[model samples]
Target: MINRRDALRASGLATFGALALGAVDAGLTPAEATASGQLRGWTPLPDPAAGGVTSPPFPKNLTAEERRNLKTFDELDFTVFSSADWARLDESHAKHVRVHWPDGHYTDGIQKHIDDLAALFVWAPDTNIQVHPLRVAKGNLTAVTGVMRGTFSAPMPDGKGGYIEPTGRQYAINMATVGLWNRRGTMDEEFLFWDNQTFYSQIGL
Candidate 1:
């Protein structure tokens, strides 16, 4: 299998080459990046666990409360959001669906989502997955907010967290690009779908 960094570099889109999540040195001139729009893309931020700044740009449009809400460490909850089929899970979608983190206390739907993806991994080992550095995208400010896609992979548990007991198993990477939003967060997963290897789309799932 191609290594994660190479695969991400190979992931073509608005994020190609250095624009795809990079390390922007502290105190570097913004002009160095402004000259290239690539500079505006998500830079490898300081790890939040170390208690540094969170989402520094704040997208310029979020309310103070919204911005403040962005500063917590909730990766497990956020990853579910990243991989969630939002139209089916997010009430915010055009067609609202119940949150796995449902309003009516603990629900089976929530547990099932975990069970389902875990089963999928066990059922299909050929599938390659990666979860990685999460980022957010700022749009028109008055409208939608965005989540950077993440990478998840094997030799690690894939969607296999949240089990209730000792048999709790992990089969995919614990690392994920699970970005939380002040509002609706997202997943910028660099995933590919294949149809017999001849016709397939390298999808950002």
Candidate 2:
């Protein structure tokens, strides 16, 4: 049986070579990406995790507060394409929110995560994240999946506390996120996952 990596390559979900990366770096920004744009066309083969199933089932007897919290989370997620106002995020996140990223980047508080994200927006001014159609909410946990599209327009942190100059490359990758809300209905913790190889390949790294 083909391995997961092989399967992703075979399905065209993952593209290879420096040329693929170089081509996108030649001025492809988020404004040029459409709902059916080429930059966002690479989709992985259907996986069980991404199946069209809503967790916690229908007729979700969620409380008004729960519903409101979920709604706020959705709004916050959309800020990647707009202004990621720190004060705004502060209002929606707990004072000590914990954030986890698949790449091992971790933030122990809301302010730190906001700072990190603010830097990302500066490097990729046109970054955009589009939420998936399915969202699952159960108890204090809420989950969402989405696509991230962005252009590296300025120098970016290399995850080693170092930095790399802009490559002008545009990238699109699938992302998943889960969050736990505090008693105040603000998100207190979150976990995010994405394909790092896909991202690196798109940026010609």
Candidate 3:
């Protein structure tokens, strides 16, 4: 029988795909659109740091540093998210739950799905946002992936043309590489996570 978890997985993937198409339509290149695809699924790729290989260009006003990040990790594994970002992700989960034969925890709102994982994934509500990491599954042998929501294109603060706007591009990265989960299985080791932050300004917002 198709279980609740399976239903949720299918719904999340479909919804996230649709959301990704919407993002590309908003202004992302085919590559930017596919960046989210990498989160849900991974294939061996040519190194992103390779030369003459930039993703679709962003608005032309971001700072040298911001632009670099936009190119390097923008489409890298999405395992990063912020506090508000994660809360908003719950909104997506809530919506998909109804369509996917959700469990009582979702439909009845009894679960209060918000937690530190979700919270850390949200944007910092400031120009600079922290990219927090979370494991989608314990001891996952393969990979876990998901899509962050969409964001509007705005000029960046560093004299760039695009800003990594909050309330948008909320992250949806699941464990992809076995590297994160294999060695650590206990809660005590969770402290090993690294905190990476991305800062930017809105150019045209």
Clash statistics: count for each candidate: 17, 0, 24
Q: What is model 1's C-alpha RMSD?
A: 13.5
lDDT against the true structure, each candidate: 0.30, 0.62, 0.28
Q: Write the per-residue lDDT of candidate 1 for residues 131-158, one digit (tens) a residue.
A: 2233232221111112222222223333
- Candidate 1 vs candidate 2: the lDDT winner is 2
Ranking by TM-score: 2, 1, 3
Runs off by more than 4 Å, candidate 1: 1-73, 77-111, 117-132, 137-205
Tens digits of lDDT, candidate 3, 27-143? 433333254455332233443222222223353334454344333233233322333344343322332122211221222231233342333333333222222121122121111
Could you tell me which 10 consecutive residues in candidate 2 have the lowest summed lDDT?
11-20
List where candidate 3 sits over 4 angstroms from the true fold: 1-10, 30-111, 114-205
| Segments of candidate 2 deviating more than 4 angstroms | 1-61, 157-163
TM-score for all models, in order of appearance: 0.25, 0.65, 0.22
